[model samples]
Target: MTDSTHGPRTLTVTEDFAGQRTDRVLAACFGDLSRSRIKNLIDEGRLRRNGEQLGNAAEPVRSGSILVLDIPAPAAAFPVGENITFPILFEDDDLIVLDKPAGLVVHPAPGNETGTLVNALIAHCGDSLVGIGGERRPGIVHRLDKDTSGLMVVAKTEMTHRALSEDFAARRIDRAYLALCWGVPSPTKGEYEGNIGRDKRDRKRMALVERGGKEALTRYTVLKAFRVYAALVECRLATGRTHQIRVHFSANTHPLIGDPLYLRRIPAIAKSCPTDARDVALDFPRQALHAARLGFIHPRTGEKLLFETSPPEDFLTLEKALGSD
Candidate 1:
């Protein structure tokens, strides 16, 4: 039998294994699964025999009895504290502001079960960091893409989480990003407004859609342009949506430099740049976008709070290479 990670699987007992225990037979059939795991699944009522749940892992298997094993989708593990480094800007009973790195995931998911910012926060804050609404993890009110580096605020208490979430929802939070895109926007200063939704053709990517997408607005100003090849721009979000910045730029034919999902091919604008500069931009390992500034009213202090960070070294290097400066 296969691992059946996708869904439930069934197998027939043969005369060669007529009298064996159910768990042992399952372990034998599912060579990739351990005997203990099969037993646990059986205990969890995940194993069925002849359309009835088999509550006993040690029950005898009859010849030709069909055993169906349901493999539940793997869940992210109970997060444990792990030491990871991030620049902490501020921390209090309400929240902690930190500069998240380009490669750090905000939390665990199916494939990323460890080495996340939440794991590090758990290690750093210990019992001080409570789970979000009773889930055993940090209160992440907002998130940057796994590869989009920069400022983020994590909540320490439930009250803070609720307050921060409300602010983000009401667009009371101020956020800005810097990105290197293939071409300069014609007006140099404008807003890209559209509804963003999952691309109909590609489930993994977001796109601007005429219907069924959330309204998104990205106000941008070109900070610098590299001949006709590319430009570094600052974008402020008026409405938050998945992949809002990348999708907006890409939709305008100004796809971000080194964006893996959006920049699908070599851009025509690259021909105008020196080969080295073009190479630097194209060879960049991740999307050339960074969260540069974040501001909001402190939930507890009521004093205005703001945090800013220079783009990571790779981003700056790409910018420099795109121009002589």
Candidate 2:
């Protein structure tokens, strides 16, 4: 997808808006733009009046003056490519499907600026991969959390990026996850629906709030159950929100094992497992969740594409310890 940020915008100051603050006038005219943003643009010399750049945001507008603001293209300062290795499932000129290992971040941030999947994709797919993703995320169409290992698809071209994103947004993409939760949810197979939003008290965490939250649905079937201690479950999402699966399971009192953010304490059900299994579950390093399957329509080929990957070795070990045969 391409950036839809507006082009050079021209506004005229009429008699009614004369003597009004430049920032206020622009902000009021462009209801979507904030006064502070207008001020920043003015300070950056993007706002011009009478063919001269304007520096002050508080300056009064003159009647019948033409104000032109040139919005520059977003900077494409992608992180330098790095020689990082991940398991590639499929690749074409349009996209790449891979099994992202646990601990690898999807994109760069303040502290994690260098080593990311984006950097790796840049190195592998070359500079062309930098132009497709709608936002700063170069090739990233969707994301798997840093600790969630599994199948992911990254677009190589803008057409593919927009198409894949549309498919995902329309819920046409087939996706499923495998998770190891602390307790087996009742009724072997069912769907959990809730409105997930930020926890009112804990800003860092997401919760199933009664008001002011996006609706989220997770359908799950217990794949394997270790008595009442824990279970391996297959989850399909109807709506994707930040930490939807983790939040839903946690809200249902069946938080995933090793989920540091959501699993705040050792669950009493752990005592029900054998001592070794209990210890293994407690010692698990990251969230026991994996994006096991991803399927979508290929934009270029007009073909149905699906990719699936087994959980990483560590996840397999954890499940084995939980008594998976």
Candidate 3:
């Protein structure tokens, strides 16, 4: 069969929405498109309220408001080019596991025009994604950061997706991450728990909070320690909160090395590096984090399944470079 990518489906609001902005009403009714995208489409004359063009993004709408929308299509196929690539670890009729690499975004968002894992999965899975998440995610059930390499399981059917989602929410699915951080904790292995919220002082970062934030828990055990500078640590998530590991470690004064937003200055432990190695270390970017292990019960078979993957070669090479003196 020929491969093709389809754009968003056009939508029209048929109900009344008195005194509500067109974009706001549309966003409330359809949770897929963001306010900005809605506004852009409206401004571009793509949206009409009751047969009238929606020029002002804030224009009020009355009851029986009729809204029209133009949705874009998905890409033709997953990456056949240099843009997107995700390592397929396991696949069956019901689900698939991917060893996602760092620098690959899980889904489409602002500033990421292409090369996302979703796009690649679309290319790879094709029609297999039809029953998963209504075409947006295809087979996607969970997500990993573009820079966080590890195994992610995707569901091919609505039943599988819902079942797996419930398992994640209940913490029945086991997620293990391997991270290289700047220092060793006083205890080799222990639990870290706190509420995580946006930092008031730095809006770009997350911080531990006493109130008004989601509760998060991360448990870590040291795998290997570098000379006073950093350690290879294993982290397990009891709850998956955004930036949970990074926030937890930074709060504990053990931020990940090469953390773009967390680490401030180079730690002294990295000084042991030879000149060539140090140069490469200086050029390395992104937090040295990897999701190495994932285990969960099969949605179809009801049997347990486990998956593991090593850190990317770049991560290992950087670690070696740091160790070289």
Candidate 4:
């Protein structure tokens, strides 16, 4: 059953879902809504089973039980539009590409509640922002880490959003990053493959593991070597796992220079560089990684699109200080 108003949806539990948790059943039924949302509905008494308000998301469901969910419209959440603006690399009817700078959070969160790329996009896109995915993150197709600078694409329409998301999930998008690591990776170039998941000891960080993790692959090539202290490398992602590039490189002991999370301590190579370059290597503010290139097909027009951007001034300054040796 379905109701247009209030988005009331009814689902009848079948043998397939019998004995499953109510939240799990609802998650399967409403693929677009997150499981947390379903739990919130349960807590708010908006979810009912057999005409009785069900407050526990983990309650077991019986076969043939009827479940009703009254989903409220999403609120206009955080990251309200601000006067802040970013550089637009490309724009069209379907999407907008931006050259995001380091230190800018991609979306607002608990600590970062304003002045995000979403806020800028909201101001820039205005009413053209498509809210099909969620009100808080309109048109956001993918994200770059707050400290990783460079090219990013955001959808302006639902059609483009779905198509672009599918492309990313299917690994059809071409993403390349430029990184300066503590030392030159061996053999100049190779593929780094591993399974990645949360670090059991440190939940906030991702780690490479031998099991129970998602497969991640990254191909890298050294572009320039700076003495024995650092090197400029190009990385292409085959699987975009959380902190995939950073985790993989760190696991290989060539962590990105200035990476606070992955690189635990200053590498011995840092002391070997020239005085100025050594100072730059030790004092760089953020990770020396940039999403330098991005390519994907236009969701609507089917035209292949590619965009490239150089790293920010700070990154370039550090690189120049390092020089080629």
Ranking by TM-score: 4, 2, 1, 3
How do the residues 29-93 of candidate 2 rate in per-residue lDDT, one tens digit apiece? 87777786787566545677887656567778999999987765555466778999989989988
Cα lDDT tens digits, model 3, 1-325, are 1112223333444445678777887787667677977775654445655554445567677665556675655443333222366678888888888898788888655466467777776677676665476444566677887778888998877889989988998999988999988768769989899987666566457778774456899999998877666678999999987788999998888888778877777767557646676676667788889989999999989989999889999899988876775
List pairs with backbone clashes in candidate 4.
Answer: none
lDDT of 4 by residue, 1-325 (tens): 4544357899988899899888998888887778977885665557767886565678789999999998876444545777787989899888998899899998765567788898888888786683645677788888898999999999988888998999999999998999999888998989999888667566457888664456889999999998677899999999987788999999998999889899888887777888878887889878899999999999888899999888889989889989933
TM-score of each: 0.77, 0.77, 0.72, 0.78
In model 4, the Cα lDDT at residue 124 comes to: 81
Q: Candidate 4: where are CA atoms >4 Å away?
A: 1-78
Each prediction's whole-model lDDT (CA): 0.85, 0.85, 0.74, 0.84
Q: Per-residue alpha-carbon lDDT of model 1 for 110-187, expressed as tens digits?
A: 578899988898888886674663344477889899999999999988888999999999999999999999988989
Q: Which candidate, 1 or 4, would have the higher TM-score against the true structure?
A: 4
Candidate 3 lDDT score relative to the true structure: 0.74
Off by over 4 Å in 3: 1-83, 128-131, 201-204, 268-280
Screening candidate 1 with a backbone cut-off below 3 angstroms (N, C-alpha, C), the clashing residue pairs are none
How many angstroms is residue 37 displaced in model 2 relative to the true structure, after the best TM-score fit?
Answer: 12
